[model samples]
Each structure stands twice: as structure tokens, then as C-alpha cells.
Target: MPEFAEEAEVTADAKRAVRVAVLARRRASTADQRATAAARVQAELVALVRRLRPRLVAAYVPVGTEPGGPDLPGVLAGALPAGARLLLPVLRDDLDLDWGAWTGPENLVAAGRGMREPAGPRLGMTAVAGAELVVVPAVAVDRRGLRLGRGGGSYDRALVRVPADTLTVVPLHDGELVDRLPAAPHDRAVRAVVTPTDGLRTLNGKPGVVPHTSAGRTGGQ
Candidate 1:
């Protein structure tokens, strides 16, 4: 083998550095603070579900100090109206995501990714397109809606399937929502952010550099 240089992207190293710093801060939080934040996050998520009233919603299970906690899906389930559904992601070996219905905590099963996923029917990856609302996990997000995700690049692939007008939400721990971060054209932006302290707020300005038709709408996304 000759030389294996880093990819030919200026933001690659910058993004990696940002991710490391952000995750470090996240892992540094005390258990008590995380617990308090989890309660606040659950309340905000409940309020969001009531406001959106989505018949189908897509969400994720938190791993490590990532927000949302373990009770999110169950809590949202109770908040939803009868016949409504909530979807949780199933991590594929290739890091792409499949969806499954979240029935209750009893149905949660541990996965290779260190997440507890709903042991329900496997919905194809494109199932996310049908969700009226999507709540994703992010390492950090900026005021302009630019989201910095973990290096896996799974959400980037699935997000393309979301409808243009559908809302994509990311939950952060207050300070994690910043003014800016390392971004390239390929990094898709989220529309709104829900913080433990601030609750929910829509971002200003256009979404991160991307074709209009490809980026899902942020009209309160």
C-alpha cells in the first residue's frame, strides 16, 4: 500500500475535531444533570407531539449521554391519539437505518449499536418518508439549522427520503445548540431544535447548502 491520505475535504478534520469536542462535553455531564435534563426533554417532546399531532412520527433511542433518554418513545406513545404510531430506528450493519413500531418498554431489545430498539416489524428504510415528524439525535447543532451528527453518516442517507415539507427535529442539551459549526455542502441541516431549557424553536435563514427539493422543509422543522 502506498499512502492512505485523508479524504479530499477541508471540513473532514474540522468536523471530526468538532465531533470529538462535543461528545466529550456530553460525556462529562453528571448523572444528576442528565436526569434533570431527561425529564425536561420528555416534557418538551410531549408538548411537541401534542402540537404536531402526527399520525406517524419517527424518533430514536438515546445512547450514552445523548438526549431523549430511554422513555421518549413510550412517553410519546401515551401522548399520541388512538391509532397513531411512533417509529424507532433499527441500526443496520452497514449503518443505514430501518424502522420499527415502538409498542412499549417491554418490547425494547438491545442492538449491536448499544441501543434498545423496538422488537417489532421491520419497516423499509424509506418508511421515514411517510412520517409527518422526525426527531433525530445530533452531536451538536447551530443557530442556522446546521446539524453535526455522529460520524456514522446513517441519517444523511435516510434523510433524503423525507418529504420536502416534513418537519425534522433535533433535541440538544441547551448549549449544544450553537451559532455555527464546521459544515460542507453535503451536510444536511435540521429545521428545529428542542433544548431542555429553551424547549423548541425554529431556525432562521435557509437550510444548509443543498438543493431545495432535497432538503426537507423547516417550516417549524
Candidate 2:
């Protein structure tokens, strides 16, 4: 067997194991615990937008057992600048993502794989390039900003269009921020992380500067 092939198999197995563990822990949490985490996370998310004041923000609807929940689009819109836009992912048949405006949860439709997507016009993949902030959904993020996703290559493809220093962020449950994760050559590094407890952190280890928000903090490596 090729050396890299063996390593690839190991990485795939490790990624699957991590996803199973995270989903199981999320499923085990009580309704109240989940609700509390959601509220705190929502607040921090709003703070991120308000502080950065980005013209366009790329975000996602949290699927089942994901930390943020379905109403995340509303939270993002609430903090947007008067004319700013929130772009949601529209999954393409090829597993790449198209973009759409976040009208509301009511405007969402049931998409394949138990996901919800905006019903607005398809804005094409290049729309992601307009985003000054990109909030990706990840199973976890290591200190180096390597994100473990739910086995889909959508975000990995999307990240390729994102400009360097675009303030990409991954929102994870507190325990999901770890020291390291399996990385592939195509993996993208996020500039920051947000959690229910830790607020926001710059993966670079510098104190993240978010204006008008005291919730930002540097988390453990």
C-alpha cells in the first residue's frame, strides 16, 4: 500500500470517530442545556457581526445536533448593517455550495441530507468571494484552525474562494475546541473560533479584538 494511502485511510477513520463522538455528546444533552448553550452562542454571534460590520457574511443553518440551531440566520440578520446581506449555503448536487440570501427561517426549505436551505435566488458559488466574514459549521476546530466537518467537502471547496485575512470563524461547542485535528492539504485555517463558554478566540493566540464586545477571549491551545 502506498504510504499516503495508508495515512489517508487513518485520517478518514479518525474523522468519522470524531464526528460520532460529537453527535453522541450533543444528543445526550438535555433540552435545557442545549437551549442555554444556544442562547449564549447566539449572543456571541451577534456580537461578532456588530463588531466587524462586514458588508457580506457567509453563514450556515445548523443541522440536527449541531450547536447553533436552525434560527441562526435570524440572529445573523439581526446584527447586520442596514443594507448588509447574509448568505446561506445552497447545496449543489455535486456537493459544492451555491449562495442565497437569508430571508428568514420561514423562507427555508427542506434540502437533502436533513439540511435546510434558503429559498431565495441562487447566487452562484462566486458569491462567497464577496463575504468579508465567513462562519463555517464544523464538528470541531483545533488550535491551528483545522476544522473537522461532517464528512462533506462543501466548506473545503468554499474556503478556496475566501480571501486570506477574511476573518473566517468556526462556531463549536466549548469542548469541541481542541489542540489539533487531522488536516488535509485542502483544509482551510480559520482566523477565529466561538464557543458557548469561551466566546471568541483568535487561533493565532493573540487577544482577538472585537469592538463593542467584551465577550472575546483567547482560549487554550
lDDT for each candidate structure: 0.80, 0.84
Q: Can you give the lDDT of residue 204 in candidate 2?
A: 53
lDDT (tens digit, per residue) of candidate 1 on 103-188: 88899899975878889899989999999888988999888778888878888888888876778888888688887888766677
Which residue pairs clash within candidate 2? Answer: none
Minimal lDDT window, size 10, model 2: 206-215
TM-score of model 2 vs. true structure: 0.94
Model 1 worst lDDT window (10 residues): 209-218
Which has the greatest TM-score?
2
- Candidate 2 residue-wise lDDT, 28-80, digit = tens: 98888877887778788887788788889999998776887668888889999
